[model samples]
Target: MNSVRRHALTGFAGLALVYLLLPIAVVILFSFNDPVGRFNYTWAGFTLDHWLNPLAVPGLGEAMRASIEIAFLSSLTATLLGTPIALALVRYAFRGRGTTNLFIFLPLTTPEVVLGASLLTLFLNLGVSTGFWTIVLAHIMFNVSFVVVTVRARLVGFDRHLEEAAMDLGANGWTTFTRVTLPLIAPGILAGALLAFALSIDDFVITLFTAGAQTTFPLWVYGASRIGVPPE
Candidate 1:
């Protein structure tokens, strides 16, 4: 009975994995397809032409470059700003700590559509022009919350004795933080940065609201879908 149960669980896990990966497998398979028309929905023939000349389509390169730049800048800025906030919330007792924690979770709980609309309204009220910088700003705003949450989770399980040991060995506060605490929290920072990058690059609703003329990759894909999507 135990062996049978184990086999059943293994089968279930295999099915779940296939379910999750089926779409990705389809996308990979379709990338090599030589479509006869704008839509690459049906398989026609396999060719390497699309892979060889990925930027054959006009504006694809520009949109990709914009997406990469925004994702990098927003992720870096969010990580920098959020790391310190996570440290403070975890390592110190301060006024409004509870309120700050609540505010940090607000973005996570809030609907993306509502957040995008609110950001649009705020930008308009301030007479801020929607453009590349506006999109970056919006991405940073949302990314920071995720960064804080991720880093804070890492800090929650941190051992204080490592920093104490560094200090006991004649290290100053700055030295202890730089040498011990920073290294220990580096994984959390990296995880948060990667998460922010992914979120920024994949964002559509917020980017649509904030970007006036600049096109990111997701925005480009969305626009292309209206006509007919190219596999490349």
Candidate 2:
């Protein structure tokens, strides 16, 4: 009976994996298809043209460049703001620590639409125009929480003795931080940075609200879908 149950669970897991991967599989399969018309939804014939010249689609290259730039800038800003907060929360004791954590986590739990709308209201109230800078601010605001959490997770299991020993050995705060602390928490920083970049690049709802005249890759793709996404 136990063996049979185990087999059943394994079969279910396999089905779940296939269900999650089916769309990705379809996308990969259709990338090779050369549709005769604008809509590439229906497979016409297989060709290497799309793969060879990805920029064949008008405005795709520009949209992609915009996404890359925003992702990099937002991720960098989040990392810079969040790393110190994570280190402070984990390594030091302070007043209103619980409150700080709650505020940091609030954005993660808030609906994307709600967050976007709130930011829009905020910018309008402050008389700040919505554009590239507004989008950058919004992305950084949402991403900082994730960066803090990811970096904090890595710091949880870290050994404090190493930092203490370095300090005791006549190493100044700057030297210890640069030589020991930064290197030890490097993995968490990297993970947080990558996560921020991915979220910033793929974000649509927030970008929709915050971006006034600028169009990112996801926004361009969404608009193109109404007509028919150009095969590239």
Candidate 3:
């Protein structure tokens, strides 16, 4: 009976995972297939043309470049800003720390439309230009929580002994952090940054709201869909 139950659970889990990943598999597969139309994919044979043919879609290259730049900048910014907050949450006890942590994660749990609108309003009030800069900032704001949460998990396993040893040897906090703590947690930070980058690059709703005159990849894809897609 136990063996049967175990097999049943495993089967269910496997099916669920496959169901989730099917769309992603289709996207990756379709991204390679360059065809003659959009609705019905004509097999012009398998080619990497869509991925490589920058000028094929006209402005596709520019959109890709913008998305990459924004993703990189925002992820890096989020990592820098999030690490300290994560460290503080992990290592220090402070009043309102729980509240701070809650706020950090609140944006992630909030509706994307609401957060995007709020960011738009904030940018408008500040008279900030809402192009690349606004997109970067908006991405960072939404993605920082992911970095903090990911890094803080790593922080739990971290040994503060190295930091303390550096301090004992007369190193200042900044130096100790730079020389000791930062290096140890670098992997977690990097992973978190990659995750943030993925989120930023794939985002459409928030980017749409915040980007006044800029086009990220998702935005470009969306707009292009509206006008009409050319070859697949």
Candidate 4:
């Protein structure tokens, strides 16, 4: 009976994963389908024209290029900034540590709409005209907290003894960090950076509020939905 229950539980979990991923799978499939659009789902044929075909649609290529650029820069900045914060939280004892943690976690709990609205107001008040850079700044602000949390998780299980050993072996702080500590935590930083990039690219509400005049890929898609996504 226990084994039967375990099998049933595993089956249910598998089904749940399939359900969650079904839409993504469909999008990936239909991205190559004939006459790619929300309406086209025949699966009758396959073509990569949608991805490669120039003049496929207006604004799409430009928006996609912009989104990629913004994602790379913003996620890179967030990871570089957040990694230090995470390292400090994991490795050091400091006054106001709880406050710092709270501030980092606060963004995760904040609603996207609220954060966007607030940022919009601040930019307006500061007389900061918005553009591609503004969007990158907004992406970094929202994505940094996630990076800090993720890298900290990797740091939690890490052995500090390696750093101590490196120090004992006459390696300086920078050498110990770059050679030993960084290599150990590099995967976690990379994973967090990828997550940040995805979030930055997929962002809609915050980008909408903060992007000002610049259009991102998702913004373009949302606008295009008003008019249909054109066939290539």
Candidate 5:
């Protein structure tokens, strides 16, 4: 009976994995497909033209470059800003600390549409024009919460005695942090930054609202979908 149940669970898990991965597998297979026309949805043939000339798609390279720039900037800014906030929350006891922690999650919980609308309103009120900077700022705003959360989770279980030991050995505060604390928390910080980058690159609703004329890669792909998406 136990063997039967184990087999059933294994089968179910395998099915779940396939369900999640089937579309990705199809996409990977079609990456090499040579479409007969503009739309690359249906498989026509297999060719290396798309791979050989990646820049064949008009505006695709520019859009991808813009997306990478924005994602990198936003992730870096969020990581820099959030690391301190996470450290403060974890290492210090201050007034309104609990409230601060709670508010950090508000952005995560709020609907993207509402956040976009609110940011648009704020930018309008401030007489700030929506453009690349606005998109970067919006991405940073959204990404910070995730960065803080990820880093904080890592910091929660960290041992403080290591820091004490470093200090006892004549290491200054800055040296202790740069050499010891930062290294220990590096993995979490990296995880958070990667998450920020992914979210920033994939963002659409907020980018749509905040971007005046600049198009990120995802936005470009979305616009291209109205006509036909090039394989590249």
Candidate 6:
């Protein structure tokens, strides 16, 4: 009976994995398809044309570049801003600390549509024109919370004895942080930055709201979907 149950669980896990990966597998398979028409949905024949000429589609390269740039900027900014906040929250007991934590989590909990709409409204009220910078700002706003949470988690497991030891050895606070503390928490910082980059690059709804004329990769894909998405 235990053996049978184990086999059943294994089968279920395998099935779930396949279900999750089916779309990705299809996408990979279709990338090599040479479609005769604008739509690449139906596999006509396999060709290297799409791979050979990746920028055949207009604005595709530009959109990709814009997305990468935005992602990098937003992730860097979020990490910088969040690291200090994370340190503060973890190391210090301040008034309104709970409120600050609540606010930090609010963006993570809020629906993307609502957050996007709220950002749009705020920008309009402030007379800030929605464009490239606005999209970057919007990405930064959402990404910061993730950065803070990640770095805070890292700090929670940190050994304060290490810092105390460094100080006892005549190292100043800044020196200890730069040499000891920073290196230890670097993994969490990098992870948070990478997550922010992924979120910024993949964001569609929020980008759509904040972007007036600027187009990101997701935005380009969305526009292409109206006609037909090319596998490339």
TM-score of each: 0.96, 0.91, 0.81, 0.87, 0.92, 0.93
Cα lDDT tens digits for candidate 6, 177-203? 999999999999999999999999999
Candidate 1 lDDT score at position 8: 100
lDDT of 1 by residue, 132-152 (tens): 999999999989999999999
* Candidate 2 accuracy as TM-score: 0.91
Q: Highest TM-score among the candidates is held by which one?
A: 1
lDDT by residue (1-232, candidate 5, tens digit) is 9999999999999999999999989877887998888788999998877788887688898889999999999999999999999999999999999899888999999999999999999999999999999999999998999999999999999999999999999999999999999999999999999999999999999999999999888899899988987777
**Deviation from truth (RMSD, Å), model 2:** 2.1
Q: Which runs in model 2 stand beyond 4 Å of their true positions?
A: 1-16
The 0-to-1 C-alpha lDDT of every candidate, in the order given, reads: 0.94, 0.94, 0.87, 0.89, 0.94, 0.95
- Ten-residue region with minimum lDDT total, candidate 6: 48-57
Candidate 5 lowest-lDDT run of ten:
48-57
The number of the candidate with the highest lDDT is 6
lDDT of 4 by residue, 86-150 (tens): 99999899999999999999989999999999999999999999889889999999889999988
Query: Which candidate model has the greater lDDT, 1 or 5?
Result: 5
Candidate 3 C-alpha error for residue 83, in Å: 0.5
TM-score: model 1 vs. ground truth: 0.96
**Candidate 1 ranges with C-alpha deviation above 4 Å:** none
Higher-TM-score candidate among 1 and 5? 1
In terms of lDDT, model 6 sits at 0.95
